[model samples]
Target chain A: MNRRQSKVLRTLARLVIRLWQMRRVLLLVVPYLFLFGWLFAAGSRMDVRPGELYGVTDEPAWGSPDADHWFGTTVNGADLFELSRLAMATSVSVAVVSVSFGIALALLVTMLFVFDPGEKRFELPNVVGQSGFLLPSFVVLLVLTGGSGGSLGVAILGLILVIAFHLCPVLTTWFQEGEDGFDIVAGYALGLSRREIVMNRILPKILRRLVGVFATYVPVVVLVEMALSFLGFTGDRLSCGAMIAYGQGLIIEAPWMAIYPGLMATAVVLVLSLLGWRVSSAMRTGPLPRLF
Target chain B: MARIVLQRLLVSVIRFAAAGLALIVLIELAFCVIGGSDRHVWRAESYGPVPPGLSARPVSWAGLLEDRVRVSLPVLFICVPGILLIGYSWGILGARLRRFHGARLLAAPFSLFACVPGFWFVVLVAIYSYFHWKRPGFADDLIVEQGPDLLTWWHAAVVALPALAAGAASQIRAVSSVLEREVTRPYLRGLFMAGYSEEDIFYRHAFRRALPALFAAGDRTFSALAGSIVCLEYAFRYPGIGSLLVEAVRLGSYGGILVSAFVLAAFVSAGVIFCESASRLIKPEAAGG
Candidate 1:
């Protein structure tokens, strides 16, 4: 083949690899982006008074489904449809942001186990991981939110800490396992320090594990958020959880209030889980790449 | 002799701790159920609609748990015992079912059945049963509407035990593998070749060697099951301490929330203590200091 032909073939190969690696993440994230867009659009047309959405008033209770009001009115006179959208956005954002923060926290913790003894101070996070796993995230979110001021930031921050701590243990274990490779020991033998060995040798072994970890965890993170929101811990504005809470009141009246958001949450979680399974399988079965 | 005594004492302490923590959690759940909701309190005028065959009594904590346990217990009994007995019997069954080749297919169903989040599975099963077995006059009629109540810890235990049993069994496989690998090491091989019989090699040598890691692995398995239960409880509306704790926060029930947290903390602290004690038992020489 000519040089041009070889170059095009190489480009196509690279694209295929990148696409395959990205497929799971794209599948999981696209629905979220769509839901979020709808939520933002719904919020822009917010007709309900602010406090009314939080259950301080009964305006949401009075609105009826119509051309103007897509979702019937709540007892508080807010548009149920509008409120649903807002809740979707709030809930998704909380889950996604908290999960992102959690993955970052896990990465940092993994680095400590793999490299940099100086970063070992964060071992407290791993101990927290033990308790964090057994105690439901919603329960922890509740305590953290209930104890702190019920500000959105406060709740999110508290949740982030709970999630971060929970993730660190698993991350630490993965890194620790990868750290046991022959390359790492060889690097140590070649006069490289522990830190150098981890950075240069162990990181490659763990790259795939890290992908598996992140992919597997996204669904779990979303479920935690849904539970929290369902309990009304995620900031009160039409969160997925808040909608369900509202639906609890309206089960006899407008069962859609609960069913819609419940279905949405369930769908999102299931998709992410399936995608995670696919990604992990791909990572495990793929041909071993040449070490540079 | 001192090491044996210490080991016995440690085991006793852990058993006490687990039982005590489980008890405290039960009491907290009772309080939350009875005192939980003051919202929209109105009497149920009559039985509106309940699934046929299932009787709906006045919403009482004791009744709710008893009812749930009654409904869930049969399934749990069938699944748990069936899975364990069948899983262990697979190799035996293979000889008989050689034409059917059922053993290979058996593990996945058992594992999936075992792995299913009990809350979701129970809810799905309950709904399915409700639809399938509908009988006349079974519908619950008028009742007082109140905020959700907590599910008893006994109920949680009953619902959780089957899953836990299945999980514990799976962990046994993993724990034994670790034990088998560690016991076959060179130093241990030398000891075994010289004098130790196979039984002594397993009990005295392997058990002692693998107990620490097995305990740690036990913790991992327990936590994974517990995590699954959180969502499961929430889904089934089983007001176990885990879910009550979630609801308490939602309702701004600070006292209830605090009590639940304390109970959870105790359970966790006890688990850690158990793991530590077991580790010490396995490596008495290391713990001597």
Candidate 2:
């Protein structure tokens, strides 16, 4: 082959190595996303939103698990498989948006109020923001949402806002802990510029810590959405928690109804948690006992 | 020193109040915008599906107050001492026994599950309690109901368990780290050179230095417990402040939500100010203040 062709083949080899190196993370994340997409498409066709289909008690109700009805049937004869998928999709989708916005807002709060870049010292965060440290996201959301009835749009917006404020004190404290008390003084004494010192000497130390924050916060936010749903504040009535609430009652009669979805929910949380621990331990300050 | 502390306390209180009052004002503004307009010159004409104005209802709910006093207060009281005793002892021990694998072993859960979903404990406890001991349906209050007076305190312990579990985990980590840093500081070496005893150096100097950190941890734990109570009450369908808020939101009762929000906001504001000032007072700089 010509030099250009050889170079192209070499690039393909490198690409294969890169994918091979990241296979562990991809093995977990891709299937969940693909399944989410498939379930979302299926839900769109079925046109089954949680609250809209909540009171759906029709014929062939409470059918047991079989070939056609994979998981089972709800009281309304709606496929439990579809229900679980839609719920998972709803919870994960909302959590994704909420965590992204929340983290970004938290970073801004830290930069603007908590960390005084001008003085290079920490300042107390807003008092109301401190209130978030005292209160959970759901309490604040309940207070703020008032009577929105947990519509999809309202739930997403409310979750984002709630999570953002709830994270302020947490992020601030983490940043504070990340700062070694003597670092700034030592850096300045060395004749380094503020920007140079921050970029070269400081930000790297804290950036890994931020990765730990992201790992832990995502699952927590997903759980937040689920908790809200558990409290009967389901948007569209489609959440993994709401499904569990409905199925849990029929545990003896139709165990599969709750069991399958419950397992799926557990699996999602478990996988995320393990992934978080693995990633954070690898990047965090302390030594880990072993390789995961 | 007393005068300085008092002055500093007053300033901190004002700052906290400003933050809280700002939120309260924002809530009122939100009410005006989203509450649908019906201002009758000086007063709102009717309360409608939602309440009319901020002054339309009394700020206190008897049930809310009872819940706060009976349920949440006991939990808070229990948690404060439990966290301090457990956090301090574990941390001081962890620092002294830094070479012991068991110290790290004990703290494993905190780092591993620090970010786990908050409600898992509540849910799991409710489920296990239900399956193990057949009580009320739907895990409502798990095993407790509006029974005898003693059971109320029992229920309080049950409710506090989740927060305590998570809080202790975090506290252990925070305490150990702080103590580790303090134990290694040069000042401790100076004390060592001065021929001070180990326990004296630890309790007097190292522990004093770590007190500010302990206060901050307590503040964070208090917040976590408070937040957890809301979720727990809602999950249990208990007649407490959390369920009250959930009910208010469900029914779209502006009076209920607003008044409850105001009271809780005040509590949060006062608690934060006290914790912060208390922390500052312990700091060496408070002398200059």
Candidate 3:
């Protein structure tokens, strides 16, 4: 083949790769938007104040699904559709808070490794974190509650504490990965402190490589919040898990209640993970070389 | 080489065992502090005796522990082999499918499954049982005619299905990555040209080289499963340690927490040490990296 033929074929292949990446990004955005959407209606806020979404009503209870009630009414005469929206919002907000808090805690703890000798670095995070797997997060939360749950704010704070403790070791281990490149060796040879070499030379590279990985954990935090709620460990919070818990009870009467939130959680978990992988791949693929 | 690996394994066993013991003591002390007790709390903090909390009645830690072992051990046994076999098969499948739509088709679903949290699996299984069996909830006495430990575990094993899927999904990715790197090595091409049979090239070479990584995946999958035991037991009410934890927590029994945490922690420590040793022992040098 002539140079022109080879060049054309290469360009076509590059085009195909770009299209695939673009499709992945769009796929990620769609589910993300759905999670944040007020699927019941944009008019949910107009119908009742956000505060009233949680309150019981004297209106007809257990009403069937109709144009006005997308998910219908609960046994308490509360709007199931509006309550569902609130549950999702609570779940997302708590997830965002807990994940950010967890990462921050992880970073703080990982920074300590910079001061430690290299041999300890290998053993400390690996063995210590592995053993931590034995201690259940639910048990910790229950312990903190002293049997009965407290306020939602306190429960969220407790949730954040539990999540951060569990998450820190995982993040630290991931951050500690990677071979010592020439730059790191040079930094060490030049008599830089372990902290300086790691902070200045190594961390930036690891962060860049794992940036997409961080988003993948959001769905888990959401699900955990729901699980705790379902188990009645989250005090009075009505998150997605709580909604599932509620719907599970009324299954014979209102199967849609449980089904909708369960479907939403499933969608979020599936899509977010796919997005994370794509993002990781895209990062690895990193701007392909320009076609001649 | 064997001696060195054995020594390292022994050292690891000693190290993690010591750590687990120390952590168990620390957890017991910590709970004592939280529940507000005297030195007697520490004195009476023996396994199998589950020193009664402020109000909870004394329950035999041995029986509860036996329940946990019966359910969780089978899950672990079932899950580890499932991960290894499925991961190994899928990795081998990749080499054949490499020329066509393999990466997209094989990878995407596994990637999704791999990231699914363990509780989600419990929830999925719970949801399925709810729909299929028309059961409102899972409880120990819910079935009065419980059978032998082995038979009872099969009932509990209903929840292990999703866990196996998640674990196997993660392991598949690990095996595939290692296989891809191993098969593409320049030395492998030279062997291809030197008249080595494809079977020998794969099983005797690439597969052996992949053993350490496969063991590492197993180790990780085990740890992940250990973390999920509480959720699994809690959801299924399988008379495991997790159910014990729920009972303890509901009744505010610190002794219950103490025993349950100790058992699970011991299991994890033992598992981690075993897996880590095996992974390192089969270094590509021994297996031929």
Model 2 per-residue lDDT tens digits across residues B187-219: 889989999988877777777777776566555
Residue A252 lDDT in candidate 3: 58
Predictions: Cα RMSD each:
11.1, 6.2, 7.5
Across B1-289, the per-residue lDDT of candidate 1 in tens digits comes to 4675477556545544544443334333323332243221122321133322222355433453345445344333443344334433452333223345343343334343443324334333334334565421111212235754222333445456545544544554445445545655676678777997766665566555655765555454434444444444555555454554555555544444444555544444455555556655567245321
Model 1 alpha-carbon miss at residue A142, Å: 1.8
Clashes per candidate, residues 3 or more apart or on different chains? 34, 6, 3
Note the chain A TM-score of all models in turn. Answer: 0.69, 0.76, 0.70
Residues A1-292, candidate 1, lDDT per residue (tens digit)?
6555588899999999997776665665576567556656765432333335435343345544578765566665656665666655555566667767876776776565555456464466564454344453444555555434244675667557666766677667666656666776677678888766666666665666666666666665555565555545445454555566555544444545545555555555555555565565456536433220
Q: Can you tell me which runs of candidate 3 are displaced by over 4 Å?
A: A1-60, A64-70, A115-123, A134-179, A182-201, A288-292, B1-59, B71-77, B91-154, B181-203
lDDT of 2 at B214: 57
Q: Let me know the TM-score candidate 1 reaches against the reference structure.
A: 0.57
> Where is model 2 chain B poorest over a 10-residue stretch in terms of lDDT?
B46-55
Better of 1 and 2 by DockQ: 2
Q: After superposition, how far is residue A281 of candidate 3 from its true place, in Å?
A: 2.5
